[model samples]
Target: MPVTPGGKASDGTRADAGALAGVEECEEAPDVSLEALGSVATTTDASPGTVVPGSPAGTPAGPVSGTSPDREAAGTGSGRDTPVERLEDPGNSATERGTGRPGVAEKTLEQALPSVLADGPPKVLAELARAPQRSRAVRRDGLRRMGIATGLVALLAVVFCAVQVLRPLPGPALVMTGAPSYTIAGAPLTPAWPGEGEAAVEVEGVGSLGAYGDQKPIPTGSMAKVMTAYVVLQDHPLKNGDDGPVIAVDAQTAKESTAPGESTAVVAEGQRFTERQMLQLMLIPSGNNIARLLSRWDAGSDAAFLGRMSGAARQLGMNDTTYTDPSGLDAGTRSTAVDQIRLARAAMQDPTFSAVVAMPRVTIAGVGQIDNNNTDLVDPGVIGIKTGSTSAAGGNLMWAAQQTVGGSKQLILGVVMAQHSAGASDYGLAKALAVSQKLINQVRKALTCTTVVHRGEVVGYLDDGVGGRAPVVAGADLTVIGWPGQSTQLTLSAPVTGLPHRAKAGTTVGTIALRTGQAAGTEVPVVLQHDMTTPGLSQRIARLR
Candidate 1:
């Protein structure tokens, strides 16, 4: 065999018509020694197999003419047909490897490649070059599969993104809240309850304040007269300043008017009086006979009229009330301060009833004038309501007063019952008026003015159908009367047609109703604070992993 030092044949020619293209080749004629070819395969850079490129994937697959019978390897992974010849090493002898086989360590491509080619047939040279090309083709197929897999992964990512972008989202978080004060707080002082009786108070549009001790049913006395008047007005409704239908005084009522020890308005049998005048006589002077006379005139008899009063009580929401007679003179007619307050609230809403009760005096034909028994009506803030007194029921008064709060007249209704004195008959009514007047004055003073909510404050937010939101703000300051330490609650009205999405700055969405549990609430307009546009991914929907 003759081989070139440059990894090519000595002839500088291929072994046959077919040969390796780029790699150095060797041509052999017969049996050859590998010693001359050992140094030919090594370079100064090739000190070990680490720097060596792998041999042309070992020998070609089938048998060849040049290989001897002893040359085949036994199950060796290298794929070489023959046992490798050893390269010279300074530390070991040539046959140091067991079985005298070649060792891969310290071997370089420059040292090993030429010897195999030099002693082999022309097909081995062609196979050396062809084996590498075959390996390169396998790698090219693997790279093509990897590229297609990469493209599929990229396509899946794109599909996931498109689905997320088109998906629908729930509306934004919309809630209304007021600015809570951390330090600006104080509880309202309790109402001054009467020393010895049942009492309660209620502001118009506000709920009941509270009922004090022994609120169970008690005699209503002349307070029953108020209910009589309420029933009378209900049957024969009258507008203010109008004299209603006239009624002739009956013989029985005229006779009772002259009774020595009974309450009555002066009257003559067969004499006619208008309905308004009759009620004035019954309510203002507390004419007991007039009360009975009106009851008989409305219903066929007194018993039937009592049934109407009881029915009226139920209709007015007076659950703890009972009526046994047309007049409160019967102790069997029982009521609670809570029940009377309910009736008083409904009665005051009528103009004819309220006006008649507030009158100081009314002129008549025979009797020059009759003064109202409810003298407290003359007080500045005090208005028309009724008073009742009896030996059994003590003194009870149902009263209404007015005060200017936030430039609007606020009506207050109250009831004080069972004010009694063992010493004198007059003490009961006097004590009731005195106690109620004091409570009214205290309430008038305690009605403090404050700004509950400020304009442009973020009381809540309006949500879009997507995940976007805009601030729902108060459009104007809410300056109104409210008690100290009162907590305010807010509620939203349905948003205007297009909200959060099409909202503009200062556009009214709805009104926020503010309640303090103290008095009538004030309503403030809710508006958007800033203009809105499109929402982002995070705002429109939950974040995608």
Candidate 2:
């Protein structure tokens, strides 16, 4: 071997050739093509260059003797520049040459492939890399789309459920109107009417028993004082047992005690009486003077009190009545039998008025004693309301009587107006009392103790709209004092929320009122005799009205 001046020979000797084309000391590369192979994916133990290549080379790394300084600065300092890893294409440079070590990743992928490949594993591996990736991408996209569709369907189902639960639903229909009477059968109540004058009587809470004679406005005598008393009590009310405010008797009213042709309470000038005592004087004794004094006391003046009385009459639906004098002394003061009965009904409701009028006689501190003009009060059933009579105003009596039958009291109110002839009050009042008592007795006889509904009896039915129903029945035996042959109408109802789905046997679903006429009679609770049930979920949802 020889060495040149700047070159070495194969024997480590200097070569003296300055000319080219001599036998060059060259070593041969592996007896194989490396340029056609893929770059190595494994890392080396030695440190790599500072910069990485943009794309991987299709050749393994090796040392280079002929590299420029610029190439070294660009980080390709030697042919052994660090090889960039390639996922897209794998290499078999180690597998093809026994001289290099393969990476764990490369060896595992190569071992898994079939050994029957004639072209070796690298090319086939490269070809199949993108196919599996596309398949995986398509499968992932399909799963994502399915999940989104499933979530949307679930959201719609939830919204649909919320709408069904939140919407309002209406209750059941009312089915108790115009239904037949629920009472037991009884004989017809044909109470006879008064033969003379005009008369009308009503069984309290029941319809009018009868209306007799020509109905027209006529003089009501002291019976019109009932209005005066009612107006006074309204202005200054006194409950039963309350003596009420004191009232002074003026000289004019006291002087009238001796007045002829007129009834008067014996009161002295400057004398005072409790309101109850004064009312007794005005009502029981039928004192025209007391009535006048009351008008003055209650309303500052007689005219104002008279206006109040007229207004009260109008309010009570007594359109047929007209008030002239508070004492009924004026013949101009007039009312019909029906109108007087209206006053009797309302006046009897006052405890003080009824208590005062019921007394047959009362003793006073100043006046020795006074007697009720209506002698019929001696009878227990004949309750005194008022009795009025004058030369112009015929005998008129507004009376209330009650009778107990089957543990229930029945009140009968009757008015007999224009009784007898217009003359002295003695005979007129006597006639009024006699006729009113007779009418009351007739009503008592006609009032039959009747059971409108029996406990456990079906008053009506609650239809569930699905061919099912529960019986709504009386909670107790409803015994009402109604006339015979009169039908008692029954009413059954529930709340706007409809009947409850489940109820006990005795749950009060609604009220059953037996109306005898325009008047509302005894009200008994209509209960669920059987356990009531509600509709199913589907049926309830369907009933959205």
Question: For candidate 1, what is the TM-score?
Answer: 0.69
Which 10 consecutive residues of model 1 have the lowest summed lDDT?
44-53
lDDT for predicted candidate 1 compared with the true structure: 0.69
Lowest summed lDDT across 10 adjacent residues in model 2 is found at: 46-55
Residue lDDT tens for model 2, 165-284 = 566544444355335565546667675665677888888787777788787888888887889889988999986478999988899998998898888888899998999989888887
For each candidate, give its TM-score against the true structure. Answer: 0.69, 0.66
Cα lDDT over the full model 2: 0.68
Q: Model 2: clashing residue pairs?
A: 2-13, 2-14, 2-15, 3-13, 3-14, 3-15, 4-14, 4-15, 222-388
Q: What is the C-alpha lDDT of each candidate?
A: 0.69, 0.68
Q: How displaced is residue 437 in candidate 1, in Å?
A: 1.3
**lDDT, candidate 1, 1-545, per-residue tens:** 34343332457642231233222344322222233234344432211111112234222222123444432331222454432333445354434333465553344233445444444445334544455566689999999999999999999977876776677544444566654331115675478999887999877763446778688999988889888888888999998578789999889988888876446788888988889888988988888889999998888799999999999999988989999877688889899998898898888888999888878788977656999777788887888688888888888888988888777877888999999877875539888888899888877766655666788788887767555668788899866554454445556565554444565788887777656444447777888888866667654344432
> In model 2, how large is the Cα lDDT of residue 472?
83
Candidate No. with top lDDT: 1
